[model samples]
Target: MIRARAIIDRDALAHNLSRVRALAPHSRVYAAVKADGYGHGAVTVAGALAAADGFAVSSLDEALQLRWAGIDKPVAMLSQQLDATVCEQAGEYGLEPVVFHETQIEALERYVGPALKIWVKLDSGMHRLGFAPDRVDAIVTRLAALERIEINGWLTHLACADDPSRPETQAQLDVFAQVTAGRPGLRSIANSAGVLGWPAAHADVVRPGIMLYGSSPMSDRDASSYDLKPAMHLSAPLIARNPIAAGETIGYGATWRTPEAMDIGVIGIGYGDGYPRHAPSGTPVLIDGVRVPLVGRVSMDMITVDLRNAPNAKVGDRATLWGGGLDPDEVARHADTIAYELFCRLTPRVRFEVI
Candidate 1:
């Protein structure tokens, strides 16, 4: 048996995708499977998310993972550096590369490969990757000159759609609309946040990232608010249960002290397995559905949790780290991070199981 593992729930994975559809009913869904399905195991979830119109990945290699796994749906490469060689491979594999910079467009214009499918990205205020909105005219005109290139869609990323009240999202959407007016191919802007918050940003396609993996794209709300199920259940076995006296310090730095004489369960998980080392005392865990507060400093391979909530928890009971009953977003908040980091940073030492 695996000491610690992330159980990928296929039904929940599909349910999350359905949630995206529910939110963006008219748009084609490009389920973001980047960062190895946000660390839920890409290929496995890709196979399960087959209902998605397509899959979005961060790099060319990630796109290949889906293709190699026999996923024939359109795979969009969101951040792969486009070059002559990269363009050729993209053409061969039918991958759509998001060409944001002028140099990338130059690479596509110069490529004599069979044909390439690509998405033209507009900066739209994120100012991260896409071409500036002012350049959209020249971008559209220049791209019109390339016979070998096909615009799979005109897409942009939202910087603050998570906060629906943020004016920047509306301004960005306005800029996107003004720039791409009367243009041809599909238009996409809604990430998971936009999909949930700004229905107007859902153009011809909506590429949802975190929500598909069962994490909230918004801070104030949770996945359950949208009826999204947790797709990844992370847990580990309780390796030891010991009695501790009041004032007994636990783990490194003696950061946590027992408030009273009680039993503490040592779970087989830690930062080494992607359970946040920064998770302070009072972070919650679950044993047999009983909520247990995490105590002490997390080590590379172990963490101690106060078992007051689960007096029946034993040495072999599996402790739920952030799924099933407990929300990953809640755990992420206690760790002073977001669920995305928790999902993406999980080390390979932790076993992954697909259900």
Candidate 2:
């Protein structure tokens, strides 16, 4: 068997969801399982977070997958672009469609079925796929007579809640409140960032995504802030250790030349396994709780890390590429990206072990 594997901790997932619950005590947490639980495996993460108020998926297909896997929680697709056949399937599978645009509303109205649960999306500020805040009343009035369509409530996405001090957060909340004022239905506006940093944004339903996977959506927060544990530990066993002389190039393009003689261990994971190819040297990795620096260019199937600080590191020594001691956020920062990309980019080449 290959030594490289992804370890998924269900306990960690539960812990993180609990933190979201605490943060938005009065709101229902819609666990975002989109992008396959942001790469932790959707069905697995959804099942693990079954205690959540509900689940959120990206498409009707994802919702169907969850249903096929026997997850019966209410799943709201963040985007709804389904055809008549797909919309019927959604009704049959008990998936909620997020109606954002007038066109989607028209489609759903045309496909009118008995089991369709609708969640209207209001464009408070993101300016993405959602009804304009000012048009909420007219849209609601139009849909109120559609007996087949179950208008459950409202949902909005936050743009800058990740920046805790941004005034835009309050502006969005005010707009959302104005649109949803005294509505006798469910109201939702919080994402992971909104749940953690913007208290006013937390309405009847809070959608927590990145945080449920043990990542802080807000740059101002970290894993420790909310008592959350990382659900994924991407690791590989050291394949070999080679000593290089000073002034010799280490990897492709010779991007990093050794300043002195050093012993480095090769790990059996690379871009093929979803590690970033552009990850520069000095990216922090963890081996037995000790920090190691990645050296040289990452290849399709291998990477070399300086083990001088971890002299005892040897072949078969565990290399935590991310998670545990090393935060995936830091790696994302080094790659000029976010944890969402880092997680979803992990290919199926690596084995996944759920704990």
Candidate 3:
């Protein structure tokens, strides 16, 4: 048996996608499966999200992985592939590359043979990728001139769509609308946060990433508010139950001390299994559906949890790190990180089982 496992709920995955459809009924969805579907396994996520109009990935390798898995749906490469050889491979594999830089455009021009599907990225505000707003018109013109390359869509990323109070999202949307005004192609701008908060930015396609996995994109809201179910339930078994006296310190560095005599259940999971090492004392773990407080520094493969509330919890009892009753968002808050990082950082030592 695996010491730790990430239980992937396929029904929850599908439910989250359905929630996206309900929110953005008019927009086609490009499910973001990058970072191995945020470490939930890209191929598994793709199969669960079969209704998505397309899949967006970070590289050509990820796009081809879906193809190798027998997924024939359109795969959009969100990052630039400036290498001529990689661009040629993208074309052959029918992968759509997001063209942002002149170097990428040059590579595509040199290697594209019959026809290449492409999404032209515009730098509305994020300033991470995509062409500048002022240069998009000329860039579009140049890309259109290539007969073998088709500009399938114009897309931009939102930086602050998660915060509704921020005005930058609207400003970015305005610039995107202005730049792609008369363009005769699909327009996309919404990520998970954009799809939920900025309806005006939802054009022809809305690419959702975190929301499809059931975590809320907004800081103020939660997944339950959007009717999305948590997909990944991470759990580990209790391998040791030890009696500790008051003032006894547990784990490395003696960071946590027992307030009273209590049973410390050592769970067979820790940073090595992708549990956050930064998770502080008092972070909650679920034992038999009851919340228990973590009492010590997380070790490489074990964490000591105070099992005062659950006296029956013993060796072999499963302790939930997140998901099910305990939300990953809540755990993420304790770790001073986002749910995306928590999901994506799981090591290969952790087993993933789809249910």
Candidate 2: misplaced stretches above 4 Å? none
Task: Kindly list the per-residue Cα lDDT of model 2 for residues 21-73, writing each as its tens digit.
Answer: 88888888889999888999999999899898789998988888899999888
- CA lDDT, candidate 3, residue 63: 89
Q: For residues 51-130, write the lDDT of model 3, one tens digit per residue.
A: 99999999988988999999998899998566877777777778889988888988876875557888999999999998
Judge candidate 2 at residue 301 and give its lDDT. Answer: 93
Worst 10 residues of 3 by lDDT: 106-115
- Candidates ranked, most accurate by lDDT first: 3, 1, 2
Give the 10-residue window scoring lowest on summed lDDT in candidate 1: 132-141
Estimate the TM-score of every prediction. 0.98, 0.97, 0.98
Candidate 3, clashing residue pairs? none
Ranking of candidates on TM-score, top first: 3, 1, 2
Identify the leading candidate in terms of TM-score.
Answer: 3
**Model 3, clash count?**
0
> How much lDDT does candidate 1 score?
0.90
Compared with the true structure, all predictions reach lDDT values of 0.90, 0.87, 0.90
